[model samples]
Target chain A: MIGYLDFVIALALAGAMAVMLTRLCLGPSLYDRILAVNSFGTKTVLFLSVFAIMVGRADGVDIALLYALINFIATIAILKFFRYRSLDVALSQMTKRIDQVEGGQ
Target chain B: MANLDLTQYLDYALIAMLVVVGIAIIRMKNLFAIVMLTGTYSLLSAAWFVSLDAVDVAFTEAAVGAGISTVLMLGAMLLTARDCKPEGKARHIVALLVVVITGAALLYALGDMPIYGDPNSPVNAYVGMDYVAMTPNDINVPNIVTAVLASYRGFDTLGETFVVFTAGLGVALLLGLGGRKEEEN
Candidate 1:
């Protein structure tokens, strides 16, 4: 009985992923694409969890957890890189420099 | 059909999603969109791996593909143009022909391989079987994959770790540990 439920849930997630991919492909802006990518990662995490249940294994949840962590970090890194144009800069330092400039002006 | 397993439908859907993402990645010229689509491609592949019951491989794919590679590519993109230059018309035909031929060859080759999860397949029948049996008795690791990777294949894992360390060192050397020096007055 639970297996059927898992299957149904997995199928719905897959359908949502298909829609997300469509949005990703049709995006008129980079932000739209980024949003799509992040949402897709979330769906993947959920799908992995449901799939682990469907397959009657506990191993997949470990992977799903790792993916959830990495996906969030990657999205942040992408946004940060685009915003600052560099990865190594400290965010606080950048904000401080901005404040200094505003004070000087 | 009543006999059809619903999970198999999910498999087909995932496969279809993968193909569509791949085509989109190819057709798009914007580097940002392409990078994002690549992540989508990686996530889809990881999910597919889960469906195939290869959790270890799926984990690696999710980490390396969806995470590390996406960030690395974005970093690399910062040094390059935002959009790809238009290719000459002649090159497209040649590229398409090569792709079609290679794809056809791969499809033909696929028929020769054993079906997925076939117990009688050579990979599952030989050393894999030994590891499965030995893992419980010798290592007492409930997860045979962990045992085989850490114990049975210790040297391979060590080598992979070394490769990753070297890559990290190279990147640090090239890019520096700290942010690029603030522009001089």
Candidate 2:
């Protein structure tokens, strides 16, 4: 049955999450931790989608979509902040580059 | 074992994971690793919320907890030390005692709550039933959580939106990201 399949999927996802949790907790380097967190976010999105189907709520997909977008943006923001030490600096540099390109065009 | 359902097993597993992650976060010395574990904790808790059929709460947790909060914490960490300073043993003991007492109090309080997802629970008996029944006719939305959040509780949702906006504005102002100034020569 469909319910059984959903249960199996949920179990598998939970197992993967457990592995990611170990990596997150035991990371010797910052980038390793970041990669683990990123992978966990992707797994969470899939888990949410499976759960929505299991619960017979098609609209749960909306939440999953929101998570997908926010997760991507957050990862980028974190990486930029880590590299530049200031989001403001990153933003201004990006804008200045864009303006230069536009002016050249 | 025969009576236990899939959801029950899943809930137990997720709760166990959450507890382990919480402990790891507390014991971590590296601030960056702690932040990463916190994000994982949030994701696990969000999954637990979904299992409880609280999609709206799960959505908010996923977005705010795992998403925005992680990024903000990383930014803050970048601005500060990557490793946490060692604390005195006395301080550690005091903190542990405080945590234990607070956790014990919370566990005691949990005894007064109704069983999860019980149809006969007071919350489900009153406003929840009405929302479920009226949502189709009142809002015509397929998702009751959406209808309740956006329509039935429009003013509350608006307030939440404004709170988020204000937080963003505060961060932007604090970071001086508003207007571009010439780099110091």
Instruction: Provide TM-scores for the models.
Output: 0.85, 0.83
- The segments of candidate 2 whose C-alpha lies over 4 angstroms from its true place after superposition are A91-105, B1-4, B136-140, B166-181
Off by over 4 Å in 1: A96-105, B1-4, B162-185
Best by lDDT: 1
Q: For every candidate, what share of the true interface contacts is present?
A: 0.69, 0.56
What lDDT does candidate 1 reach at residue B87? 83
lDDT of 2: 0.75
DockQ of each: 0.48, 0.38
- Per-residue lDDT over B1-185 for candidate 2, one digit per residue giving the tens place of the 0 to 100 score: 32137777789889999999999988888787787788788878888887787777776677678776876787688578878888789998999899999999999999999996688999999999999999999999887877999998999989778756754653453345554666652
Task: Record all residue pairs in model 1 with backbone atoms less than 3 Å apart, i.e. clashing.
Answer: none
Candidate 2 residue-wise lDDT at A102: 14
- Which candidate number maximizes DockQ? 1
